[model samples]
Target: MGIEIIHRPLRTKNALWLPDRNLIVVKERMRSVHTRCSIAHELGHVHYGHVDDRPKHEVQADRFAAENLIDFAEIRDHLGWIGHPQLLAAELGVTHRLLRTYINVHRLAS
Candidate 1:
């Protein structure tokens, strides 16, 4: 909960969590939604004690971000009128990746 967040120029990454420093560094050029989602994803790594970039850890982080960022009620409202993933993501104020991760995780859980 004491993790620090800073915006810095990252050449090739959206965001990353520094375990040693309890800090989350986000790329300065990301859009608002992406910046927020990236921070949430990095916080997931902090919450889950992730120190490496394993696929499972990545998914876990993504799921954490999606669940927190996209409300299920909002997704449901969009689902009735929206059929495209991109549209749904846009309407929900999330990236397409987050929308897909939400679906995939819920699919697995159900």
Candidate 2:
């Protein structure tokens, strides 16, 4: 995928990396935010040297993705003002699961 993001309709449901092109292709039906997340996650794999045969590489990539997309200080400020998890998730274009996970993982809620 020469472009920033590739949409492959005939491919699998999840995003895949074309190592030959050094690109990440995701499903055609995926949301723009999800596509962005896929790109960031794949970039994390490259940035963190996750190419090695490690058992928990996927987990690390996921963590990196969340960290890259989310800002703990911003979340804390929004939570302090809004007091609604769903609204914060909606603003961030992330799932409620990830919003809650970020709060818990970063101790944002105290």
- What tens-digit string does per-residue lDDT give for candidate 2 at 1-110? 24355778735445755555666667787777777777666666676665542547765666677788888677756776346877887788765655665676677675
Candidate 2: residue 75 Cα off by (Å): 0.6
Please list the C-alpha lDDT of all candidates, in the order they appear. 0.87, 0.66
Candidate 1 weakest ten by summed lDDT: 75-84
Q: Tell me the lDDT of model 2 at 97.
A: 55
Clashing pairs in 2: none
Q: Measured by TM-score, how close is model 2 to the native structure? A: 0.70
TM-score of 1: 0.91
TM-score of each: 0.91, 0.70
